[model samples]
Target: MVETSHIYYGTIVHTLSVKNLEIIQQAVLVVSNGIIVKLDRNVKDIDAYISSASCTNYVLHRLGEHEFLIPGLVDTHAHAPQYVFAGSGMDLPLMDWLNTYTFPSESKFKDEQYAQDAYAKTVHRFLRNGTTTCSWFATIHLAACKRLVDTIHDLGQRAYVGKVNMDQNSPDYYVEASTQASLDDTRLFIDYTKAKAGHDRLITPVVTPRFAVSCSTPLMRGLADLAKEYRLPIQSHLCENPDEIKFACSLFPDCKNYTDIYQQHGLLGPDTYMAHCVHMTDDEINLLATTQTGVAHCANSNFSLQSGVCDVQRLLSHGIKVGLGTDVAGGFSPSILDAIRSGFWASKMKKVIERDMHGNSDYVCLQPSELLFLATLGGAQVLGLQDLIGNFVEGKAFDALWIDADRGNVDLIGDLTIFQKLEKFLFNGSADNILHVYVQGRRVSGVPDDENDLASSGDTLNHGVALDHTTKPSI
Candidate 1:
């Protein structure tokens, strides 16, 4: 029989698609070397299967009745540097907010020690919130960006970290020096990240141009070329606010609209993802779909900063991929769960507005399964990690969160249906309810390390040693 590393038996919940929430009860999942090998359900005799497989050197973790395993949440867009001021500075529009708070806070990252201190907190907070994968925007300072990459790597979280590029804009205190300097620093940052990652794709570098408003035409073109040269994915903002849009268009009068500017610069492609396409026209949406560029719907940021509400339903109807983004300081939270809640409210707000306009509730509301998909599978598709994550398919990496619905934030007062339990967790659950967070089959976050967990489990882990540096006890 094959020697497996670990086997988990319990209820498993995950999205099969945007509309399908598959729940498997009494399931046995096999993992070897951090990759799922097999998932068997409704086993009549657990002992028989284990003996038949001749499984030796395996850790059997059994979940409680109130506990279930779900795919880890994915955050498609966020600014790691902006996390320092996440809860403050929400009384202004996009452009004003950037100048007043965002720019000044990001500029301080030029100090290496400060970057390290702030970045550690940001990454740890996201991990505790069950975000196994995140696509992060680091400041333009090359050294600070490199420090962000190192912090994520050490924490064992899967991520796409980008060194922001901006060669033009109003603020002289925070903008890049020139197009050449931005391109050179970006190349160095990309090379540094690639070398640091070695054989592991856990951390990747993205080309971030901030937005067309701040980036020069030459800088945008150079970034497009750099993305092609490195075969890396690109991320940036698009049509987030009205004033920002007008200014962006004024900067490039030859272009028809905001989306056209990106397409003209060879910046729109399948390998690229844009955030907050709240004000995109039908023609622009078509351009994105034609180019196969993914969109990150940052509902929390939209609501917090008073940016226009994005119709995620519209994006999906147009066959354009959509994902959830916290957008950090603008969103006022680092948790993807907050993104899910904000997205739900935004969809409901759309329904209300439509009813007010037409006297009937014809707007579609996002179902729980769909919200789960947006937070997980949809984000994976946006990051081009659909093949590796977003679900519990065989031969895929084991990135998951163990949900204890009966503890912490959620309360099981009486007999409830499985769907009710799931809904409660989605609406009310917090990090306290996530008993364990695993990335690539390794426990990256969970309960605190204690003597009980360090105790010998079996032949595999022994002598009160930890599973790894990032591993914590899950009870």
Candidate 2:
């Protein structure tokens, strides 16, 4: 068993809302059994606070002057197999890109060893970049998908893993045998994930339908029924590009629009989230708000793939939940920090276009705190994990990253305020600035004890235990 209680004296930064950022300087935080138990601001005596907790054997970590804790990033969309080709295939658009680069590359995952190596590197890279939670899209191969789950479990990262489902429009070599086979394999994948880590709620299996263009009507309906039956979250692509939207509407003529295709199949609900609604109609936005479904704003992928810029402000104004996603391979980056930068640019580009073309001079750009909220709490609301891991609250889990603003790529020369330091880290920092990454009190990644090296030796020393391997949840 591992030590269950930990205390830290440092500066704590978290978002109170989209535009409001709360920074507590010289605070004491108490985390026991992976949950934050106490947070006292303006703490003058760390020793007195520790005594008040009545803890003698608990570990107390002190933060440096340049270091502060922020909530871990939540990636709403990413592809596990595609991380191998993240920087490649940027020249092609959505449909041709999928045919040439995506399908062929994903098909190679039929080899279990290839999937294992690729998934390990991908998950490790995300954790190293301080992404504690992710929603991953695996290939159609069930065994390879299961291996992806095993990798995340072994690495001690929180994630929602989905075995991609594509039966109708995919290539012959990569597609499932039939609609029935697709549904059966999806059921099997859900059962495996639940039986493995159901109690911990760390790793969950999501129902993925690939997209409307790739899945048949019968297959989509079946997947929706499975989601309802298992009470699992559903994720898929929606109205990303003009060509993609055109094709999806053509596929289902009976439906009114691209969003209606999924809605007609009983897939739109509070538990479902669709990625890249770049070309959504006003009616469709209203439909999403009515159904309480969320959207994952993948600005990096959209910009790289030549997809249109998504108006996140419009979505937020309409009461639709929104979050950030580093749609790797399509996005060309795995870091949610990169996502935040790209998303900010995407919003500004939209504002500029509106001002120049539509004679709208009052368009507003997204603020830094708004972008931060999209990366953290907004993502939590998207994946239904808001109450557990979004912010630094008394009852929330301690999922956070220790960022050193004075570290590599970010040189703090003069004295700066607390918010100024945060802005520097957000705009100018890289992975080198992340000193330590923690998920549920487990240090998944961090800087090495030796200044010249990384924390490689102890990276896997204390991983979150799988419920399938142990009778009780490991603390």
TM-score of 1: 0.94
lDDT tens per residue, model 1, 336-430: 89999999999999998889998998789998889999999999999999999998989889999888888776889899877788888999998
Clashing residue pairs in candidate 2 (N, C-alpha, C atoms within 3 angstroms): none
Clashes of each: 0, 0
Taken over the whole model, the C-alpha lDDT of each candidate is: 0.87, 0.87
lDDT of model number 2: 0.87
